[model samples]
Target: MKAHRLLTVAVLVAATACGISPTDVQDRGNAPTTRIPPPSKTIYLLKDGRLVLEPADVDNDTVGSLLGALFDASTKPLGERDTALRGFTYIGIKDSLNPIQRDEVQLPRTSTLTVYIRGEGTLTDLGKAQIVCTAQQDAAFEQVRIVRENEDRPSRTEGRYTCGELK
Candidate 1:
């Protein structure tokens, strides 16, 4: 009986030293009292005829990975159709018309990033517009120049563009 009383006093002393009351210890058995919101990142998407800013709860903030997700064909925006708006592709090789299927292409950290498109196809002008605007959103790329794979020079359709003009 004496040892039990001493143990209780020791526990009370330890709790007081830790700045936690015995009542607080008991209350801990209750459900969690605080909830922290998950971290999120802001990314742009094309909807209708404009780029829309949306917050996504992504794991990390790697620019390449974020670009990949933004370009992913399966990612659907809220209140939108299941299909992706930007289906444009490019062929980096000179004179080759092969289409690069992925949504994103990461260029070396440069002031101007050149995006080469397949010279001819059903690729719409809207897709090209989205590509230019989306790439320029990155801080590393201040200007985006779209060109054809086989063309030596940038055509009127293929030239330097800024996000401001498109978005």
Candidate 2:
């Protein structure tokens, strides 16, 4: 009887150790899966006329997504004193636009990034510089450009300028 009792206790312990608990044995098909998105891209934001690179872990690698990360207000910069992009909305993705008469689109194109703004407002020169600098950080894009929808054109092109060059 003692040997039998010891064997039962050992079996129970081994089962529990093997993750055979009754609760854990229930079907887990509906259980929520916790997945963490890995950081795969770098972006630049503006603060005091200087560009700061920030790491972003996003599900999508589109131009608009990168812009969204750069403009996110909650992101903390490397330096406590650094600030993020002031005014910009991630509209969507697009390939073509009219320079004279533009409309809002998000995650537009790898070569050309379109921004959606609210009301009659637009991104300042410094803001555009921030966008350009941030977009260029991605290796996929060779000459990333910024186009503000229903807003004025940026003062400089992407390849020709840097965030530090902004004033």
Candidate 3:
């Protein structure tokens, strides 16, 4: 019993001797923040003449991956909904000066994403809406500019558009 009391006293002294002091909680300002990723991938397709957001089974939410999925005929939702992306072929994401030569392209955290495409036919406003809305599904990309490149003519800007503007 004496030894137990002595050990308890020694523990108490050692704990108190440490530099740490009991104090009230400090107000250290706001906590750090983080961007939460979306629960599922989404792509824009046309329901009748209007744009509609549809859940996609795409592997990643990258601009290229989403565009690729948007263009893929097999993945198109059945019934009235159809893809306007068929009017143009998805080339790649336009970098600072040139298009990225890859199958998948991930945009920077927050920036405008420019996508290069070769229009198989005359790209209508609906086509532009499809491309713009589909690309903008990734929150990192605030706006999308569709650049149409033709073999016989110089590339032309279809106009920068946001999902809200098109849809």
- How well does each candidate superpose onto the true structure, as a TM-score? 0.43, 0.44, 0.64
User: What residue runs in model 3 are displaced by over 4 Å at the alpha carbon?
Assistant: 1-39, 74-77, 95-110
Q: How well is each residue in 28-118 modelled by candidate 3, as lDDT tens digits?
A: 9998899777634777778878888887768875678877777774344568788666656778895333333455874434467899888
lDDT of each: 0.54, 0.54, 0.76
Residue-level lDDT of model 1, residues 52-134, one tens digit each, is 66654456664344444545543444565222334444433122123334468644444666665544445445555555555
Which pairs of residues clash in candidate 1, taking residues 3 or more apart in a chain or in different chains?
Answer: none
Each model's Cα RMSD: 13.1, 12.6, 11.4
User: Looking at model 1, how many pairs of residues clash?
Assistant: 0
Ranking of candidates on TM-score, top first: 3, 2, 1
Q: Is candidate 1 or candidate 2 better by TM-score?
A: 2
| Candidate 2 positional error at 126, Å | 2.0
